[model samples]
Target: MLTPTDVLKDKVAVIYGGAGSLGAGVARAYTDAGARVFLAGRTEDTLRKASAEVGAEYDVVDALDEAAVEAHAGAVVERAGRIDISFNLVPRGDLQGIPLTEMSVDDYTRPVVQGLSCQFITARAAARRMVAQGGGVILSLDSGSRHGTPMLGGTGAADGAMDALIRQLAQELGPSGVRALGIWTAGVADTLTPEKLAGAGAPAMDEAALQGVLAHLDSLRMTKRSPRIADIAALATFLASDAASSITGTWINATAGMFPS
Candidate 1:
């Protein structure tokens, strides 16, 4: 039974923040694609629940911890026999609602430091193993800020930094047989819970306001609607597979129609 799924039959994948809504979706997609997925994040309860759904393994980790990330990659390689794909989707603490002029130095630097460090450590850990294995794919989600968003204070800045990191990592690792790419997505309704939204100080867009944003996004898009988590996760899986092996150093849009770059 040769199939596309067989493509990842023996591959090992590590996904950070796998307990989060978007991460869970991606984890399930990867697991279904036949990869041995490792779910990592802050909470054991959430990680365990997500792993069970994905039929994957779970770990508690601070993605920015270079030592811990390296160890996790080593362990995954040892257990699954190889590390094939890595996705670092750790959330940055970017709820600073102040306008750009009013934002503090600490507020702006906070997310950038956390976001870039996570991507750096996790990607470095995976890249070391992957380069040794001859090649692999690395993806860092939360790139919507690359194109720029007015309402997002630090988020846009953080994502812009990550986007740059992805490109540089791709260029450096390409010769080593590793590929790095990013997908930008924003305001996925399903992933935005009331509690999460309130905590993040996200726009208090009422039904009409939300619709307006969607409509505005739709007008800018070639497509009318935003992508679902399944859609983004599916593309992410493909990007990790041989099908997208040549897509290094590029930021793909899974944003439906909002961001055009």
Candidate 2:
């Protein structure tokens, strides 16, 4: 009875980075789940194109600007009636696998500050709306940082801070009927690209190198294979639904076999 379609029927979902590959994948999945999705990003063209794929509305939003994010959230609320789901998929511009000594202070600090601030702004805005409207879900993706990665260049630190905030928000908002949760996904083949990594200060990560890294992670997985974006989307849909009503304040890894507990 609680299929993904049933889970999202008539709901309104907002994805902050909906134009990018990872965000697009989730947007498509959410649209397919019967929610009226809103896809937002910096580029209007990309947002429009990606929104077309999901039959969702497109908007230009700068998630980093709290005022801009608030305005966008208000518009989405006006259009959809209420915000059922809010997902922050903005790029963190994380520093590459540079050696700790080689990494610049700005390189390490920028992502942490950007990520935490963005999460704070977006989540707080959505939480306010959801609280006034009764109930909703907030979702985010991070590396989970369970196993302190030495060369991940402040990624773990940023994600760790996010994880902390989500748990606290879950506690504060659960009584008000808002669910706050996060996903940890490191390797998705379709999204791994040289340009993408370059934007995050990494040299270039080709499909081969990405797959190899994934394979190594798979070897560590309970399932022995890297999970796809679909896998992450599936769980996200569930978490955003009432099915995960009692699952607040937990960091669930959608990775197939990698980083198994």
Candidate 3:
């Protein structure tokens, strides 16, 4: 069995949006797993802070900018010699809590566009290098809201688009010794701050109401508890490691059975 301490020994992992809550968690886990992690995001301050915590390197790059992403990938390979893993954890800029009937066309399509755009920009940049290097892993993440999560406005559409992209990318890249996959996770208690929820256009919730929401999510899961950031980080680390060499072209369920495969 591969232990967490060295599963990714000396591997080079580049994470886009590496300053966010989930990205930071995964960066820490990857560092602990002995990977040489390079954290990239638009915000230099937060990226520096996250890098400090994990002893990972930091870079400022916008994942949505194709030129910027391509340059950043080249820089990573220039420094690390090769890119073994690439993960995109960028925010999808989605607005929820409003019914589609009450939403504008742009509001309903923004996430879908942003999600596919960033995924393609970053994934293609990495895939090209991976093809040259002979093998690599590309990882993505989504809320798994595609299974009809009502009131989430554009989120479901975005997730569905991402699902299709990963599947297609895997098929096209697999022959080049590259693998593409994703994770479907939602309602991770640790990633959900009151401010984050509010920013997503959810109504402000008092402590009692917040607990009620959490309980509802728990009730929907077979485990009766939502997966946390640590759980997600561990799974991501495992998937990116050589231990999961056979896994590709699929989104692994990390939703605690909220949507069974």
Q: Which number leads on TM-score? A: 3
lDDT (C-alpha) at residue 25 in model 3? 96
How accurate locally is residue 185 in candidate 1, as Cα lDDT from 0 to 100?
A: 76
> TM-score of each candidate?
0.91, 0.93, 0.97
For each candidate, what is the lDDT? 0.82, 0.84, 0.92
Stretches off by above 4 angstroms in model 2 are 205-211
Residue-wise C-alpha lDDT for candidate 3, range 135-211, written one tens digit per residue: 99999999898877889999999999999999999999999989999999876887887788888897888878777
Clashing residue pairs for model 3: none
Give the per-residue lDDT digits (tens) of candidate 2, residues 1-261: 867566788889999988988888888888888889998889999998998887888889899888999998999888879999999988887886788899889898777899999999999999999999999999988876746677888887898899999999999999999999898876665676667766766656777876675566678667776667778888888888887888888788866645554
The prediction achieving the highest lDDT against the true structure is: 3
Q: Which of candidates 1 and 2 reaches a greater TM-score?
A: 2
Task: Summarize candidate 1's per-residue lDDT along 1-261 as a digit string, tens digits.
Answer: 637666577778899988998898988888888888999898999998888887889999988777888888898888888889999878887764568887778877788898898889999999999899999999988747666566567888888899899999999999999999998876565675545665666567666666665565556657777677888888888898887777899888776757667
Clashes of each: 1, 2, 0
| Candidate 1 similarity to native, TM-score | 0.91
